[model samples]
Target: MAITHFTSSNSFQGYHITQQFDFCSGFGQFIDEDGNPASFSMAKERAMQQMLRAVPTEANAIIGFRVEHSIGSYVHSDYNNCILTNLITCVLVSGTPVRMEKDMEQKMEKVLLVMDYPPALPIRPYLVTLIPGQNESTLVQLRFFSYTSEPISALQADIVLRTVFGEDIVLPDIGFARIRAQDGEHQTGFFRVNLSDSLFSAQSASVRIKKYVCGSALREGDVHNQRIDMRLEDLFDLKRLYGNDAVAPHVVYEGGWQCLCGAQNPTDEKTCPYCQRGGESRQVAHASLLRQAEELHSACEILACLQAYEAEHKGSLPLTFMEGLEKMASTERMFGNMKKECMKFLHEHLEAEEAAAPADVPDLSEEDQAAMGSDAEIPILTPNPTGDGDTAAPETEEDRFTIKSPFDDPYWK
Candidate 1:
């Protein structure tokens, strides 16, 4: 139940609190629409969230709520050389922490907000937060809230329910172990997560949102969502909508199932010949996900570079670029050769960019250095024969590309 669902008497109140409670005041300043704090209710919600923190538990509602808000503008800059104004909203909320009655709070619940940044990624999963849910011997609720326009009926991701003792319970069972959307048409999804006995024995547990292979940020130990604490919102955001279902690898079966490693094997085969993975091995899926993420990331980088080049040239890729790309990509794509080709292309491109880059300025002459103390408006540039403006009076090496022909560079016997 939501705080809004709480009526005057049917208030946001219960006995079992959602998270570990602290006595901190709820107050925050947020940049919101002008004169329209209602346009963004999240400002108020942010203030209330400081009251509760993730622990081995979950709370359904809040009680004894008090909220205050103000919307106003501040002079970011004043007239003279800079005059700018911006609007901001401040929300202050205070609430007595309470949990649902035993009937309602028996099960702990964790809500992960679905999000996408640096858009066009193939897989975007709900957060794997620090305190995802309680690991105690009890059924826990897991929820995904996506402010997506269209319904996502089929979405899947591999999740590892890690215990406090450093044991990971892989969701291998296709039936109940998957972290995926509800079977039918739905905008949001929920699951009653069941963990192993070993996990429950530990004090607390966390959900590990695996993306080390997909993005560089996560690989460098940066927070996946750019924040440690996961934010949960009850309201659906219509203006900011995300309805992409390429969240994970879709299950495909062609007579015999395909391995995550992109290899096609017959049903009788116990292991994949290309990747050497067991037919029922979870490692196959896990490794496949990582490889897919890496490929997607590499593709994005190459695509961005191509797009930038096209934008600068105001048209399609230059003939030479296309020819070079075709030649580089002529290498085998299966296995890991594709990545090597991409790296080779990038290395060559870097050399070309460095050659086109401007040369650095030269140090002042002995006489000019001495003249620095005087009011001498010393010239920094001189025209060379090239007629192009540069810091030097003489031409450096002209940018050149000469590929030695195999037929001419060395005589073949």
Candidate 2:
């Protein structure tokens, strides 16, 4: 007879077991006639039949095998399987996360006004108050004396007043800065500064407000090292929008399936491979959904950028969905091309290895070695010298390919 016991740590793919129960009656307890103790084989068969009947007729469910065991006897000398029955369950799960993020990105597609420094500096943490027509037209007060001892020169100090305020105005006084060029050329992308002793030395500086330009500023949340505490409902809401069906309704928190899926789980389960839908084989659909969600998220980012630009520039608008998708397609194509180029390099490397596998070294005689060592004897020029007067020098051919650093030799100096 086939063994009735089964132990699988994880849910097998393609099956679904929603619930299970184990019923064991104590010895000498059951007096009901209909619930009489049956033989082990009969009890096991009946248990199997029960599971078979539980399988959903309308939809698929895991009904692999059901075993009934006799733990102890009930009102009898011998143990009976019917009175001490144990039940096991299994199920299949499926889903993908494609539609959720797309909806979210679209919903939150708003322009964000911000400010940025050229050399990516930490947030100044202090606020600056400025006046347009009064008090030297503009004032910037630092929280404390800067590390640089000398008052930062107008050439070195740059202040970019950003607000997503105006896209067309060529900002004056605030757009010039000492921009160090990588290739020995100077540039002024934006912002020129005028530091004042009153603004710098005073505990605080306040000035009349005037016209200002604006740009995007990184937020506290944008900081790389900051910890994030996100709510599960929000995560699930996002997932649901993106069509993440694999997101389990019942999150197993403490024991199993503990991976975070943008959702907070209070408990966990050892094997959550079963869903209302089915098992592991269906997980591929969910993987594809995740990919879709990522794409949608990126699309949202582009939309946000457009909105930011529009906010800064009046009469502007965000790109159409199709236009954004075209850009995305182009980006994907470029990425694909880059991947192919990388693969080509790997292939070339393998080919080079194969070609070099049987490489041979040419034997050099003593004379050849001596000739290679002494370069002073070798002629720098023959009769056909390009320079002005040079007597015909001995022309001894030597390998000039021997590696040497140009800086290593003092002759160049």
Give candidate 1's root-mean-square deviation (CA, Å). Answer: 31.5
Which whole-number lDDT from 0 to 100 does residue 76 have in model 2? 30
| Segments of candidate 1 deviating more than 4 angstroms | 1-24, 32-40, 54-58, 78-80, 102-413
lDDT per residue (tens digit) for residues 54-164 in model 2: 333432222222232334423433254444433322222121101111111111111111121111112111122332222333322221111121222112222233333
Q: Give a tens-digit lDDT track for model 1, residues 115-141.
A: 332122222333332122345422332
> Pick by lDDT: which candidate is best?
1
lDDT of 2 at 94: 20
- Runs of candidate 2 with Cα error greater than 4 angstroms are 1-10, 14-38, 63-68, 74-413
CA lDDT, every model vs. true structure: 0.38, 0.28
User: Candidate 1 — what's its lDDT?
Assistant: 0.38
Per-residue lDDT value at 66 in model 1:
66
* TM per candidate: 0.19, 0.14
Model 2 — which ten-residue stretch has the worst lDDT? 97-106
